[model samples]
Target: MRALFCYFSATGNTKKCIDLYQNYLSLSGVESDIHNIDDGKLEFNPEDYDMVFFAYPIHGFNAPENVLKFAKTLKKCKEKKRLIILKTSGEHLRINNISSYSLIRILKRRNYYLTNEYHYIMPYDIIFRHTDLMAYNMYEALKGLVPLDVKDILDNKIVKLKYMPFGHLLQIFMLIEHPGAKINGLFMHTNKNCISCGLCEKACPTKNIEIDEKGKVHFKHSCLMCTRCAFYCPKDAIVFGLFNSWKVNGKYSFQMPKEEEVDKHKRYCKNSYNRYFKIAEERIKNQK
Candidate 1:
């Protein structure tokens, strides 16, 4: 059977999981097409695939806008397409994590059947660094989930690991209380170490970062809180915290590679550039 895997990821954890999951599909003899949720409508016809695997990170209480937009594209289709949502979150979503309720509702409205679903606890992709051992264990646990998910999907069984209204309630609380989505970029600043490299500006999905011709960095909002700009900054120049400039610890950056960081970036950059940053550029270009 033919399948499509469409995903949106900022810090690479979701992408890494998809990469590993692809092998499982291959072993099961399922033909699969993998695409990032970007660039308007995907090239393939939705009806052509037997099933669609929608993979993405759980941003706060919801899916990323890009992923939602992709789903929106298929809203009016009359085809009865099956869907499997593979969500990656940083421990908040132990299983399907009730936050998916909203997404499932949206898809249901669009008339798509969710045949299977699962979630993986990816390494902490935000905030402070995770301890090395903790990172390893989390990675291992997430990796282990991949095989089970693959088998379940191949068996045509629906898997719901957890279901509770409390998770949905937590989403509401986080939405009201978590300032990360509202003002994350507001506190970001470019320290003296920044080489005026435009990498962070390019990495951000939200176009919240602007680097002028002279390399002066500017932070403005509608931040996704994906922390791409902060972690991908080569110089550790972009920091998010109250009074960021005064922090004695200096700006924090992700030096810890998840295995050949530079190599993985090289392989994944072009795809991500096409997937996320290009959309941001187009939005700005259109605004002008």
Candidate 2:
């Protein structure tokens, strides 16, 4: 049976899990094709594959907007088998299901079967700002146990011993409302350090950041709080106030070298050149 692994990743944590899964599948002799959602539009015949894997990071307690759109599009297909949703979240796995549950309800209404749902934990996003190294280590250990054929592991009594208590606590925490009132609206701004590198816009999964007519970076309320922009920023210009304090504390900071910095004035023009040139090359090769 063939499988299709479709995924969206921002900080590469989800990609890391996908890589591990792909490696396990290969060792188990499973035939699969992996695709990055950014590479191109997915146009596949579901009849050609026996299983489909939707892997994505949970953002703002929801699946990234792009992944949600992909799921909606696939719902129109007549494939009968349930799709596997492998999600990675900054929170514990139990709370992670909050978003997956919403997506599953949508797909089910469209006649798609909901197969097994799995959640893995990763470092918190810049918005949520959590840093528990112990939790991260436990998450890694659990991931190592998920074999290509996970039924056996699922049936084992020891599974509960490993993940139950923490999972239950996460679920309980998900039910509690934040004491602080939610912000109705906000905007992100870049400081002078912004090299105008455009990496923030490119890394944003929701496409919420854009260059305005005056050539200044602007953000919308659609941000998932994933902090891909702040974390990946070459110049460390993007700021989100208290939401990004963990980064300020150096937990999520990713230092880039001076040589890697892009010119502030040439950001958009250079990005456009690279994007179109790559597209042209792909078109030419496909025509052959």
Candidate 3:
């Protein structure tokens, strides 16, 4: 069966998992193609492929807006038998709520059966300045949870048992709602090292950072705090308190590519920053 694996990865953590899945799929002899959703538009007849796997990061406990748009567009097309969604979030999977459930219902109406849903943890966003080493450890722990026979489970009617649900619930409540929860402190002040290149704004998955009319960097409340922008920054101006100094020890070791290299990675289809800017501008105009 032909399978298409489409994913949206901002910090490369999701990409690492995708790569692992691709390798495993190749070993299983399944014909598959993997593409970053940001590289180009996904225009395909759903009838041609037996399965569609969506891998993306969770934003504010929901799928990124672009992924949601893509899912809606797919539902408008021909029917498909199996649809699987895998989300990578710093948060646990059990908190998968009404928003995610609603998306599944939309797909069901369009004739795609919900096969399975999986969630994995990743490093917290540095932008939010809340780095949880425990979350990173949990992400690493998930490597052991990968099923030996993903293909066998694909067409199975049962939602396979995976993850610790109670653990996930506890995590969600403690991390998001608990008053005593420690903040990540990701958005520290910009230093003289900043070049005003606007790379941070473009690299951010949430479109949280933007250049105001005064040409200063501004952040919105919608940010997921993913550190892709800061970690990917050339000048190293963005910091997360002491993390900056800690990261500096590994300086020249991380090998962050040049701005051109970053621009070429194609994580978002077209530059989402521009689209978000236009939307923000329209909202401000309407408010006035």
Candidate 4:
């Protein structure tokens, strides 16, 4: 069978799992194509593929806005199309059972069948989120889940799914998390260590980072809070905190491409690239 594998990966973990899943598909002799959703060149008719495998990182216990938008983009797809969701997270327990529910709701809107779902406990790179040793242990534990997941998908099995706690609570939490996730970017500030290399600007999936005429980088409110900027900043200059405090910053290392090489995996976006920028702009304006 043919498949379309689309994913949004802040760090390489989700993409890494996607690659292995695709490799498994290849070994099974199934045909498939892959796309990075934020490439900003969204195009696909899920009706054309026998199955669609969507993978992404769980941000703040919910699917990123882009993923929701992608679901809307597939509105015209035929009904009963097979869909499988794969998420990668650091704390799978807190990935929020509602996260999967949110995705199921998205699929239901389009009348797509949720055939199977899975999540991987990949290494968490957020510095304050987890330590290097914890990440190593998590990676070691989660990596083994992939091979079996691949076999289940290939065999068209009704795979069991895992959910996080507090269904109603997480559903309500989403409302709060929505604004909190976006506003988190407002807390992102660059330090004196920033060389203005524009690394953070290019690495953003939402095009939330912009360089003004002063050649200084600004973080807009379109952020996904995936920590790509904090993880990729060359000098560790991107600091995110609460109440202007940096002590709680997460420190995790993620391999990043050079600024010029970012386009190979992601698209460069600015405030205008996001639909809520006007509101985000107003918020930023009022904050100052």
User: What RMSD does each model have against the real structure?
Assistant: 12.2, 13.7, 15.0, 13.7
4: Cα error in model 4, Å = 1.2
Report the C-alpha lDDT of model 2 over 1-288, residue by residue, as the tens digit: 577788988777787777777777666666778877755467775557766778888765566656766767664556475467777765453334566655665666666565566666555554333334323443444355455225432232222112243544453354232211123115457788877767777767667789766757888766655566777777778766446445522233222223443333333334533443454445445544
TM-score versus the correct structure, for each prediction: 0.76, 0.66, 0.60, 0.78
Clash pairs (backbone) in predicted model 1: none
Clashes of 2: 0
**What total of clashing residue pairs does each candidate reach?**
0, 0, 9, 8
Q: What tens-digit string does per-residue lDDT give for candidate 1 at 91-210?
A: 543423765666676687776678887776555565334444444554655556677768778888887646675776665565542355546557678778999879877777667788
Which has the higher TM-score value, candidate number 1 or candidate number 3?
A: 1
Model 1: lowest-lDDT 10 consecutive positions: 245-254
- Lowest summed lDDT window (length 10), candidate 2: 176-185
Pairs that clash in candidate 2: none
Comparing 2 and 3 by lDDT, which wins?
A: 2
Q: Find the candidate with the highest lDDT and give its number.
A: 4
Identify the leading candidate in terms of TM-score: 4
Candidate order by TM-score, highest to lowest? 4, 1, 2, 3
For residue 228, model 2's alpha carbon misses the true position, in angstroms, by: 1.2
For lDDT, candidate 3 versus 4, the one ahead is: 4
